[model samples]
Target chain A: MPTLRLLAILQTDCPTCRLITPYLNKLAANATPIAAVSQDSEKDTSEFVRQMEVRFPIQRDPGFALSKRLEVVTVPTLYVLDENDRIVRQEPGFDKTALNEIATLLGLAPVATPYDGAPASKPGCTSRHLEVQTEDAAAAALDLHSPRGAKASSIQLADSDDPYEYCYRAFGDALPVVPPTAERVEKMLRAAARDPQEVIARIPPCYGEATVEKIAANAVMAGCVPEMMRVLIPLARAVADERFNAHGVQATTHFAAPLIIVNGPVRRELHFNSRQNLFSNTARSNSTLGRALQLILLNLGGARPDAIDMSALGNPGKFSYCIAENEEENPWEPLHVEHGLARDQSAVSLFASEAPHGVSEHNARTARGVLKSISYALATVWSYRACMGYEATVVLGPEHVHSIHHDGFSKQNVREFLFENTGVPLRCYSGDDPGEGFAQRGLYKEITIDGEPCYQKFRAPEAIKIVVAGGTAGKFSAVLGSWASGPRGSQMVTYPI
Target chain B: MPTTLVNPMNERAPQAAPAAPRLATLQGKTVALLDISKPGGSVFLDRVELLLKQRYGVTSVIREMKPTFAKPAPAGVIEKIRGADAVIEALAD
Candidate 1:
């Protein structure tokens, strides 16, 4: 049975395929036998057929088997085959002259003209089968294990649809995210070396189960390299710790977010930025690691800004706030070590805090002088009149640390000095004012400083935390005010990585 | 063939729970006013307590304050409020 026919390989999203639809219909109307192969899902293929008013018989190529077998590289590839299945003529894209020539060969009048309001020629989209090949290559390079047993739900995307746009619309943080394709997620899961179905933590508000697979997907979206999974695993546990009060942190109408501080050998190994512009987007490790946690909170935990996250004046740190302790330049033990972890051990400390307030003391040359200037700023934590209930972190710059360390001030000495020296003058509180101040609450102890009566700021020296960071060139330090302190509020949690 | 991606969101289907039965009336009933411990939450609840007593004849108004406003009500607080015929919670910022 020898019969000549035309074969067209197409995908719904290719513009060239849509452009050539009318010409293909014209040929079909001319009594030409044609078979069209659609490299798309059944749903998408049906829509294309109905919308384009396709007159020819079309068949679905599941998994792009037919396109792969035919070695098709570009979509809208038209082939004129003889009765023996030998190619007589082929066109890869839309070309009016080529279509007219093919029409002439079929003993028909010209089917295309310049007045068609279409381009004379247009390039075609790559065949869908090629994407699988590229993904397979990447998987092999990463030595990824089987993803068949993955537990998370899967979404199918047509080859023509923009994956980035689809991801943004579906699960974005009002910013662009990397598409969490199966291959990329699998790579992260394999690196984690943990069961994909293992539940790390249940995020609050929605209490979504953050399985390893889901976290990997979010990490992929946050643009994290696979190596960061080790840090992220324990970090997730810290967020879910009962003492952290994640439910309150997520739902509160206050400026509080989990600030991650990385310490130990992993900081150097992962190249986390602990130097100049400590909190800026200078390092990929610092930026992506922080972003991954936020994505996890937003996607897996469902703490969407418009929904559960009701911070009145949302802090910028909600976007990404992570830093490594500059242990090399630090005069005191790193924050994690001070909290009882070994110096060599890797750990992540989570604190619920507001944004950093920079303090400039370019004129101070002694530890006493530096503490006095920082104390003035520290006096305003939580509120100018409120005291004894808040906590703060003093991110001392290298230059400031140098001055303090040169004066032989130990870390404890620094904490004690800040606690005693920081206060609000009693004269600042008016008698007509309500009971917002500690003076009215009967919680204040008056002390004289420079012959002026003032109320002490923090209840204890331990309420102030200190960490060394930033460039040695600047005398700038920063103070991060805590959301709330003690058992009732969020307590800083640290977990070893 | 279509491209497949892993779902990055929490995939658990949300379970539907029945809402609590509504109170028939406030008169001659005990009401619980829960102040979430925010700065102005107590003031809001104070007015609510006054209105409930003056307008609805609510008796035995019990006032409860959470340790902090940032978290859910503690189990003890929830149990205490469970005894009330009606409860009003203030969510002032």
Candidate 2:
């Protein structure tokens, strides 16, 4: 015997739909199980249920995502699917004869005096789905409901039950997350302004396909608003870049996290703090945007703490470490402009780095003086005497950026100064065991400058990326060392938002 | 009142390939010793290699080390180890 399912697609705003709603109500109340799919907001759908005395479950289409897929051409399109979910019969418009046939098919007595004191037949209003003619666009529009263009299932829970517990059982990372309700995901999808089924990239470890809808689910869990989707979508793509080494980063024993820095006009639009408490939990966009990416990696990529993510000592940044460049406060070009993106274009740069260590230069007034203190802080990147030729980010506070600029040093000048000054001497590279000594001495790495094989600090001048952020009151800067700087580990990736 | 919630997990089961046939004996066989690069791994594998050569009469021994202890080995490393009659890989802490 085939399982029975009846779906009635209707719009409360349509008059012909209102005329045929009584028969739909009768079928719902007495005949069989029916779900009324309404192409309207929940408020309007609930009002329609009350006014029309509808007893069936009113499923909110919210964005018309389901209506477009069912190809509802009119206001009153009805469908009945069998055990295999294949449509057995479809009825359109208000017809008394069609109502009688539906009642008989549902194993009810044939309708006697159907639509009493009503017209025999009436044409329904055109479906809003047909308003968009292109099939590809229409299909893309439905991605919020069907992520990756696959069939979706929504489970029902008791209203008295806690929603946070529902997400924490399996899809959580030791934190209570906002439930990724269908309505919430739909709103997030619309904010992204892209196809929900669009494949951003395949996340590593588990290598799960990260569709826009799936990514939005994670974003919703992170307590992100709809507008934050604009930032999170591009961010979801940045981790998938091979240069970022997200695969190795996930499976590594090294303490590495995806460090993100937002630049250009979007910082202000999203209210990212480029000033005081920039790296702290000062802005909703900054914190949740970073948290959303981590949630995506955990839920979609399956990079759990005890599983593939084998960080020996995971950093607090594993929760979230995102900050925007203080573009207006900085004297030099913003971080994105250094990466060749136009200053007007909003972009995000992803770096695989450790937690930040503060570098204080309170007494240093000149550029070289500040650089001297910063080089020691930079020298502690991979190891104090290791001299690892890896990348490091120098987050210059607003005061330090101005102090360096006032001394006539550009961002490149500062990077070059750090590179030339930071090194461990040949005499200091010795220990008990030769093999241990070589590994500890930052061995097998040397840069020749002025006819001297000086064991240099970084691979190149640009290895020291200078990002100017934080407030102006402090004479402090921060250094975040890289995990592994080349193909050996993750490199920095800049994605235009 | 009852409310409906959505399931946020991948419902599809993982697709795993079938295992290879078992080997009967180790005599005159070329065995591979793979180290995951973890601490104390080489010491354990050294004793195992010695036992295979002296007691089991293994012909040749192949050795390989994973790039890092964190991730799985590269495809080339796996193919190299697969050339042996039998392989012993460590899971050291």
Best by DockQ: 1
Q: What residue pairs clash in candidate 1, if any at all?
A: A248-B70
lDDT (Cα, tens digit) per residue for candidate 2, span A156-215: 777776777866765656877888888888898888888776656557667666777777
Q: Largest lDDT belongs to which candidate?
A: 1
RMSD of 1: 24.0
- For all candidates, what are the clash counts? 1, 1
| Highest TM-score against the true fold, candidate | 1
Q: TM-scores, in order shown?
A: 0.73, 0.69
Tell me the tens digit of each residue's lDDT in model 1 across A1-497: 34568899988877678778778999999788888999877887887777667889999999778898889988889998888889889889889999999877767799986433344687777788884342222211110111113389899998898999999778756889999999999999899999898766667668677778888998998899999999888887778776777777877777988889999999988899999987999998889988998898888778889688878888788888898889999978899989888999999988888889999999989999999999998998888888888889899999999999999999999999999899889887876654566434478778777788898889899999998988889899999998877777877887888
Worst 10 residues of 2 chain A by lDDT: A138-147
Error of 2 at B86 (Å): 3.0
lDDT of 1 at A108: 76
TM-score for predicted model 1 compared with the true structure:
0.73
lDDT of 2 at A410: 80
